[model samples]
Each structure stands twice: as structure tokens, then as C-alpha cells.
Target chain A: MIEFKAAAVTAPDSGVSILEPTTLTLTEERISIIGANGSGKSTLARLINGLVLPITGTVEVDGLDTVKQGAKVRRKVGYLFTDPTSQLIMPTAVEDVTLSLRRIIDDKSERTEAALTALEEIGLGGKGDVSVNALSGGQRQLLALAGVLAVTPEVIVADEPTTLLDLRWRAHVGALLRTLPLQVIEVTHDLDAASRAHRTIVIDSGAVAFDGDPAEAVKFYRDLMFGRPTRTADA
Target chain B: MISLLGIYRPGTTPLHKASAGLKSLMLLLTVIVTMMVDDPVTSVGIMCACLLLLVSTAPPAKATLRAMGIIMVVAVLTVSFQLWRGEVERAIDVAADLTAIAALALAISCSTPMESMLDLVSRMVRPFGRILPPETIGLMFALTLRAIPEAARIFIDARTAARARGLERDPRAVLIPGATRTVGFALQLGQALHARGIAEEAKPERTEKKPRRDRRSEKAAAKEHAAAQATADAETSETPLVTYSTTKPANDVAGPTTAPEGNTSAS
Candidate 1:
């Protein structure tokens, strides 16, 4: 039910528009946004979680206005940034997930139990007390997912969550994301990842260049991304 | 200059065998005693004892000397200052006091693992009852200790980058970006704390729950809770915890480039 009505986002300092006026409704359970770097894909994903606000127009999450209800909207929309290292704020894996439940379980013992359960769910049970800095890239990303998942948000927004990972870890993270029950919105450059989504949107120069089924959208995106001549499908 | 906090050196000395908490306690006691004693002989005696203790630990002499160089400089300066003020005996006492303090500090650095030190501090502060969760404080102290060197390294790198861009003379080059990077680091740390589930609000809940229990049961409960927590922690820590290895591998080598020369003539 997330909707963006004529949304236009611009960089505050440069006053350079990154996302052009666009109206779109995200009603599907899972949607992937694909674009090159500086193509404003991340900005669009961030808007869902109120990490970035539109300079013009309105963004609403399930009828809640993002600008006025940012805190509540953030609670519903969990964000996973590209860098797990940057996103993981806690010293240990268990502690990080436990932090998300701070609003829910006030008791230290209860909070610890809940956090441990969340970690166990993610296959990181044995690493509850291990320092976050020591984990491998893949493990950290999974830990980051566990942190976001513990919050029990309605919508999960990830920005290139697998970009830094190796092939195995990348697939592992992708599969993990695919399995989540919540509404998923992922911004990625990975064509395979985009193909797995139910719907795909191609963004270029801060505007939607293509929006349709994954296969057609990917094809449109590929041509647009590589600067190939406009195909009949694009038109 | 990269140096990690705790990588075990190959040693089977008595100092190594002593419990980290006991060792820390002994060091604290010795430092306190040194501060109290005004007599030159007692100060000198404590200094000698500290040196003997450090030697018994059997770390590399070069490492010890290099590490203690700053303390030695301080001791020399104290001696010189006292002598300049025409107090020869006082100078000797001050020098001996500085040496003792330095020796005890070095013993701490050499014998105790950083994790154990953190654990000891947490245990010592546990009775404070949620005014500060000892574990969170321990983590903060560990992070602050770890970040000091890291922050210095970043500052140096930033300064070098600014110099290379020929902005060395501009105060903004050194100050603004350094502050920005440090703030970014602090934000990352705050985020990490959030991820771990340790918030400032959780502390008061433990205190609120304290009043219902009888004093004896509370003590027993605390003990049981600590033991269970320890057991749970031990199971997770069974694997050899990865240390941030400071050693550089052979392949990744880069040439040292000088910072760009600044233009002071612009004024």
C-alpha cells in the first residue's frame, strides 16, 4: 500500500534533482528497483523508510504520511544499507538484534532471550556473544538482517545488500531475503536478483524508464544501462 | 604503526598464570601504595619491585623499552625539574615514583589480556545496580581504548590526503574533515550499540525489579544469574576468538609518498 505521488527528491547541498517527478504504487509483495550508480535507485528505496524525504510531492506508507509520521513509518519500514559494517552498530551480534527489541521487551533477561531466539532463527545462534567486527562479510550481513528482522517491521527495504559479498554469500543473502514474509523492496544492480522479484522497475536520470514484469523490465534496464539503442520494448 | 590489544606471547611464566583479575587488583594496590608513600626509599623499593615483576613476565626487552620510553622521558623530566628547583633528594624521589608507576602500568599491558581486563572491570562494577550496566561500560571502555589508536591513524591519513591536495595550509583541511570523520565514527559506534540491544533505558528496569526480592535471595539470585550468564558466554566463546591481527602480510606493499608542500607565501 506504499505510494509515492509525484515524488521528486533532490540533494540538499547541490540542489541537484536525483529523482524526477514520478507517481507509483507498490502493492506487490516483492518489488526490485534496478539502476546504475547515481541512477537514484537507492534514493527511491530510502524514501520508503523515510531515510530520505522528497523535496516535492508526497510519500505515504500504508496511508501514513512519511514526512509527518517519519518515526512511525520507520518502525514499519526497516532498512538494510549496502554496508553491514556501517549498519551494524553493536559490538556483538546478539547485542545488535537485542537492540531492536528495546521498544518491545524492557526487561534485560527477556530482551536477551528474544535476541538469542532471533539469532538462532538466522543460523547464528552460536555467535550470539562474538564481536561483530570479527565476523566475515557474509555473517555480518546475516547478522544485520537478524537485527532488522527482530524489529518485526511490516516492510523491509534493502539497498544493494549483497554488493560486497562473494558469490556464495551473495546467493545466500539473496535467498534469505527472498524467504522473508514481509513486503520486500530491494535496490540492486544484480540482474539475477532483479529477475527473482515479482515486479521490476528501471530508473534512470531520477525517473522510471520501465515498469513491468521482471523479464521485460530487466531487458529494458540492460539496454538502458549499457547505452544500447532503444529497443521496441522500451518504446 | 599498528598494534593489537591482546595476542598471547609464548610464555609459561608465573605472571602469565596469575588470574587477570588478581593481577589487575595487585597492580591497583601497588599504584595506590606508591602514591601514599612519601619516603624516597619506599618509592625506590616499589620501582625495583615493579621492574622485577615486569622482568619475570619475560616480554621482549625491546618491546618493554619501546613501550616504556614515554614514562622514562617523564621520569627524567621530573628529575630535571626537581634538581632545577634545588631539591636533589626530592628529584630522586619523584624519578623513583614515576618509574614505579610506569613499571606497574607496563606489567598490566604485558600480562593481562584485554578481554579479561574488560571482564574484570565489569565484575568490579556489577554492584552499582543498573546506574551503569557493567558490561556496557566495559564495552565502551574497550571501544574507547581500541578507537584511540584508530582515530589517530585516520587523522594522519586525512591529513596526508589534504596535504596531497595542496590544502595543507588551510585550517579547514586538517580540522573540518577530521572532525567530520570522527563524528561519523561516533555515529557508527552509536549504531553498533543500537544493533547490540544495549540502550540507556534498559538499566532502570533492573533497579525497578530489585525491591521485590529479599536481600539474601537477591544476592543468591544475582550469583546464580552471573553463573548462568558465564556458562552461556563460555559456550559461545569456545571457539578461538578472532583477534584483529596487526601483522601485515607480504604481498600488499605500497611506496611512501611525501605530503605536498604548502604555500605560506599566499598571505
Candidate 2:
């Protein structure tokens, strides 16, 4: 379980506070964060992975303090960025996934085998040898996920993982995420994706304005985003 | 304009098919030979052979000439410098040797793609075992090749933007922001690397033993077969799919009635 206690995060230059002092515990199996632009949803996700340390207060993942044991915490909490292009460090798909397994699988043959298996799991079995720069946006995102899952982290935090994808791929990636055993925390602007999560937290002005069932949270977010009371539970 | 070094022109010429290790080795050997053979005839012969090999690869002649022009200018400067120092014979020999070396280097680059070069390096370093991850090094090379051009483009764009804002005269307006933006890009890249599980801490050792099968040879054959199949498929497809075509225009054709009259007219 991950817990953020009175976490307040600020941008490096602007001195603008992104996440206000707020304590939140993510004990559920699947949690979705919903917010408008500048509501600090991404910042909150970054905080979980130690990508952004809190200016005040503390964040702990599985009792591992983020500030003191950031690298350890990050090992447990795998992060997926919005852009796969940015995430893919290697030139080829297989090579990219193989990088993650390098520490875990000591033998050269085992690493290749594990990487291939991970690619096959993501429906990209034959693409291990292909250059990463040539992959389609959807394929790249899936490959990125394959790379992340190769590490076998306990918590998976994705920041708008499917934001750049088309409808078909967005659904494909979302479905894959739903099946993962790891505790998944996703920050998304997509209302439909938020609705599917077990719990949802809506952030407004750097604070949690609403937190409860996915349906209620979605309603609150829609109302806040569109400046009108959205029909509850269905829309 | 995109430089020859940056742009990749696809082809299946013999030069393209040559192993990167062989090409690199040949390039190095030629350079050494050029330096060793100070005789003018030997130098000129090596340069001609390099040029011929480069030409046979079928790269844009303009690119070859441009590279040659740069080399020649440098050679001339070196020769002039030697002459100024009262070393006439040394100047001619040095200039000739330098020309041969430059010609040979350009030929190698023209013949081999960046990815192939990286693959060769990776393969060459595999025997060393865990000192440096070949894949990581290859990826670094690819990223460097890709990012250098991108960073340059970004700098140009930033300069243009700064100039438009009437801050062109201020050095800080250009250099500071450009540096900041580049650093920001690098940070994003680093974060992206971390997110994808390719962080330094995540380097996994090669667990599998090398198979008896010649894997590199198999890979090359497989790539060729795939390319052949793709080309055949492209030829067979009746309606050529313009892969980059956006949804809006294609939508217009699929559902003519849905598009507004003005939009359809504009198209």
C-alpha cells in the first residue's frame, strides 16, 4: 500500500504549488485519479514514483520512505509516462524490454527468452527485432508496458498512458492494465477510464475535491470540469 | 536541409549488406594505410578507390561532393600551414594522406547505416561479458544520432521564437533559454528512460548461453526475407494505403454526407 501524508509539491521555477498539503492512502487494488489540466493529477502520480519529491510532508510506498529510499521505492512502484517515445530508451523493442530484465535475469539466454515472452504477452512477439523508432504509437505504448512489466513491480503508476492513442489502442491498453495483478494507480482525463477504476479521486486546485466510488467521482469531476451539474452515475 | 549523416535512404546495395564490423575494420585499415603510404601516387589511388566504392553505393552524388568539398578545404588549410612553416614536401604528402583518410571515412559512412554500425559494435563487444551492456551502448549511439539533429532543430526553433519576441539582441534570451530547453529535454529523456525500466539500476545480465546456431547470420537472413515479403505485399495491394493520411480526409471519402458542405468544398 502507498500513502502520501500531507504531501505538497511545487514546480521548480514557477513557485506554483501543484499538490496542496493532502494526506491520501491508496489501499485499494485499483485507483483512478481524475482532474482538469493544472489540477496536479500528473504531479501526484510523479510523487508516487519519486519523479517529483514533495516540497513538504512525505510519501511512502509499502513502508519505504520516498525521500530516504527513493531508488528502493521506485523499484516497487513502476511508472509509465504519457509518451512511449520518451519512455523507450533502446533502439529495438526486444532490446528495450531486455534492459529491464538485465538485473533480474543474469544469463544472456534467459534475458532474451524473458524479453520475448513479455513481447508475446503484449501481442508483439515477432517485433522484438524491429527498431523501436519504426513502431506505431499504440505498439510503442504496449512495448513500453512490456518493458515495465518485465521488472515485475508491485505497484504500477501510469500518467495518461493511453492519452495519445487512438480509440482501438486506447481500449486495448486499458484492457491490458485492468488484467495486471499489480496495484494500479492511473491518472487520466478520460472519464470512461476513470469510471472503470475501483476507486476514483478527483483533484481540483491541488486538493482532493471529491473521493469515493468511481461513478460519484466521475460525476463530481464532470460537474467541476464543465461548470454544470452532470447527470450522476450514468453519462 | 537535412545532412547526409542524418538522413537514411533505404537500399539493398552490396555496401549496405556488408557487415558493420567489416566496414569499420576496412575504414580503420584504409586510414592506417593512407597515413603509412605518404607517396602521392598511393594516396591518390586510395582516394580514387574510396570514391569509386562510395559512388557504387548509389548515395546522392551531391552529398558525396559536399563531403569531398569540406575535406578538400581542410586539406588545403593543412597544406598551406605546412608551406607557411617551410615544409613543402611534407605539406603535399600530409595533404594527400589526409584526403585519402577523409575519402575512406566518408565511404564507410555512406555505405553503412547508423543502426547497422551500432549492431556491429554490440556484436563485437558481446565476448567481453557485462563490462558494458552492448544493447545499452547501441541504444546510446542511436539516441545520440537521433537527438543531435533534434536538439539542433529545437535550438533553431527557439532562436526563431526568441527573435520574433524581439529579444534577439540579448544573448541570455537565446542561449539561456536554449540551454534550459535542452536540459529540460534531457531530463524528460532521463525520466522516460526510468519509467520504461531502463534505468541504470535495472541492467540485467545476459542469462542465456549463446546458441550453436549463427544467430547474427539468421537475423540478417530473416530481415532480408521480411523486407522482400513487405515489398511483395506492397506491390500486390490494389489500393495503396498512404499510411500517414489523417482520419478527417479518409472520413470524407467513407462518409461523404457526414462532412459539412464547406469543409468538403475546401478539400
Candidate 3:
């Protein structure tokens, strides 16, 4: 279970409240967050893994406080960034996965073998030595996920993981993200993807506007966006 | 799309399987020999031998050579300068020496895995462990490798974006944004690393007791550690993890701690 107790995020320079003080407990198998641009959706997802520590209150994953036990909490929470380039830090595909396994696997050759298996699992079997720079956007995202899953994290916090991809890749990655066995918390603009989640949270102006049935949440978000464009225009 | 510096082509060649440490040592020896060798012909032969050794790895020789075209051009310029000084023999010697060293370095870089290089780096810094944390250095090294290509790409994109805006020749137009973007990129890289928990490895552990170095060596180790701190401090300074927070008021504003660096795809 993940819980946020009145967690708030303030801009480091502007001193503006980004994420308003909010409290919520999340235990769903698949939860999707939807909001408009600058809606603080990513901030909310990042807090679960200590990527964005709150200025006040606390975020805990399965009882481990994110700030106090950031490292231990990170070991269990895998974050997938929107841009795969920065996340795919290694030169090649297999090497990237092997890097994640280094903490757990000691021997080099064994780690390489396990990394190869992980690549194969992601349908990138023949791309072990391929430069990460050469992989297509969709493929690179998959490779990033492969690196994350190699660590076997209990929770996956993905922030708009497929926005950069094409339509074909969007569907492919959407399928992949949906079938993941681990607890998945996704923040996406794709309404179809958001509707697929078991529960959806609508974030408006840094606070949880609605948290409930996916269809209802999406409907509320739609109304928030298209329904009253003038009201949200300056937001 | 490969760097001239890191175009490792793994194969069954002897150089491929040979240990990186051994190759590194041999490369060093060759450098030492180059300094002493008086005959240009011998140095030229050595350079060719090193090139042939690198070629034996079955790397895309054409691409590697093309990638390193800048180095070759610089070598030619150096030799030309020596020739203009009316020292033809000295020019040949300089050319041979430069080619020999570059070839040898390329061969080692091609054959060695980056992981081994990082391991060797950490091991080399172990003696200075008290003052310089090996894990931080190792991570920074890895980040540097990744950043070079990323920076190059960013420069190109920034230039293109400038051209689109009709300010292609304005130095400020290109340099300012390029630098700001790079700093932003560095911050994002730092954040990514922090999220992955790589930085935690450098922190002192409170959960476990570590083995003591040695009663006999402690005095010596501490003496060495203390002595080295002065030298190390002169060469080192702190690298900021993240800073410079500002954001426009919007529902989508990232937390102030979040770098406003553009993470959007150039595509």
C-alpha cells in the first residue's frame, strides 16, 4: 500500500505551491492519473518513489517512509521517465540492463547472461549489443522498462511513458504497461489508456479532484478540459 | 552513430578476450617506448602494428577511421608545422609518435568493456577512499561517457532550432540555450541517478559494521590518508546535485525541486 499524508510540493525558486496539501491512500492494482498540462500529475507520481520529496507531510510505500528510507524504498519502486534517452544511460541495450543487476549479481559474465535473458523477455533478443542510441523510440521505451524490471521492483511508477511514441508504438507499449504484474501507477494524457486502469484519479490544480471509477474519473477530467475550456484556459 | 572513443566491437579475436588491465599496461609501455625511440621508421612500424591489431578485432575500420578523422587532421597539421620548421626527419618522427599512441589508445578502448574501465578506476582510487569516494567518481565517469554524446546531440539540436528561428549566426543564440540546456540535462541526469538509488552507494552505512583495515596498517593508512587529503583537496571540489528552481504558475508546474530542463524530445 502507498499512502500520502498531506504531502505538498513547492517550487524551489518561485516558492509557489505545486502540489497542494493532500492526503490519500492508494492500494489499487492499476491506477491511472489524468490531468492537463502543468496539472501536477507527474509530481504526484514521482512522490511515491522519493523522486520528488514533499516539503511537508510524508509518502510511504508499503510502510517504508520515502524520505527516510529513500534507497530501500527505491529498491522496490521502479520509475519510468517520459523521455527514454536520459533513462537509458548505458551505451548499449544489454549493458543498461546489466547495470541494474550489478547490485544483486556479482559475476560479470553471469550478469551479462541474465541481462540477455531480460532483453529476450522484452522481445529485444537480438539487440543485446545494439547501441541504445540506435533503438527506435518505442523500442527504447521497452528497453528502459526491461532495465527497470530487471531489478524486480514491487511498484512501477510510470510518468507518461508512451507520449513520445507513434500510434503503433503507443498501442504496443500500452499493452505492455497494462499486463505488468506489479502494481502500476501511470500518469498519462491518453484517455483510452487511462480508462483501462482499474481506478483513475483526476488531478486539478495540484489536488485530487476526483478518485474513483476509471470511467467516471475520465468523464470528470473530460468535463474539466473540454467541458469548461475557458475556466481551465489560464490554468 | 557511434563515438570514435567507444566503438567496442566484441569478437573472438585475441585482443577481445585479453584482459583490459594487461592491455592498458602494455599501451603505457608502448607510450614510454615511443618517447625514447629515435628512429621514425621504427615508430611508424609500431603504429601500423597497433592499427593492424585494432583491425584484427573486425571493427568497422572505415567508420572508426572516419570517426577519428579529426585526430588524423590534427596529426597532419602537427607534422606540417614540423616540416615548415625545416626538420623533415623530426616531422616524420612526430607524426609516427602521434599515430602510434593514438592507435594504441583506440585499440585498448575498442577491446575493453566500459565496466572493466570503471572497476579499474575504483580500484585505483581505493587508496584515496577516505577523501575521495570511489562510487561517486565511478558514477560521474559513467555519466560523463553518456553526457558527451548527449551534449553533442543537444548542441546540434540547439543549432538547428536557432537556424529555424533565423538566429543561426548569433553566438548568444546558440551558446546560451545550449549551455542552459546542458545544465538542465545534467540536473535531469542527476535526478535519474538519484531515483535509481546509485547515489546511495556512496553514503556511509549505519546498518552494518565494516571490517577494520588493520592495526598494523592503520597508522600507516591514516598517515597516507591524511597526507593525501591535502593533495586531493587541491584537485577536487563539490559538484552540486541540483539547484536553480523557478516555475510559472500552472497546474502542470513541476515541484520547485524539479529541474525545468527541457525533457521534451527534439523529434
Model number with the top DockQ: 3
For candidate 1, lDDT tens digit of each residue in A181-203? Answer: 99999999899999889999888
lDDT of every predicted structure (CA atoms): 0.74, 0.76, 0.80
Better of 1 and 3 by TM-score: 3
Give Cα distance to truth, residue B145, candidate 3, Å. 1.2
How far does residue A73 in candidate 1 sit from its true spot (Å)?
A: 1.4
lDDT per residue for candidate 2 within B1-267, as digits (tens), equals 235453334457776777778878888898778777767677767777777777666666776678778888989999999999998877887877777776666666666655466667667777764787776776677667656645776688888988999988887777887888877777888887655445355343323232334445455555555555556768887534333222122212222223333431100
Report model 1's interface C-alpha RMSD after superposition on the true interface residues. Answer: 13.9
**Residue pairs with backbone atoms closer than 3 Å in model 3 (clashes):** A11-B256, A12-B256, A38-B251, A38-B252, A39-B251, A39-B252
- Best-fitting candidate, scored by TM-score: 3
lDDT of 3 by residue, A2-104 (tens): 9998888999899898999878898998999999989899999999999898887888899988877788888999999999888877777888888788777
Give the lDDT of residue B81 in candidate 1: 89
What CAPRI class is candidate 3?
A: acceptable
RMSD of each: 23.8, 26.2, 16.2
Per-residue accuracy of model 3 over B1-267 as CA lDDT, tens digit each = 336535666677888888777888889999999899979888888888988887787666776787457668878999899889998877888788887787777777777767777677777787999998876676667778889988988888899999999998898888998999999898887777767766475574334223333444555544445445544654575523121112122333222332235631110
Candidate structures ordered by DockQ, highest first = 3, 2, 1
Restricted to chain B, the TM-score per model reads: 0.65, 0.63, 0.71
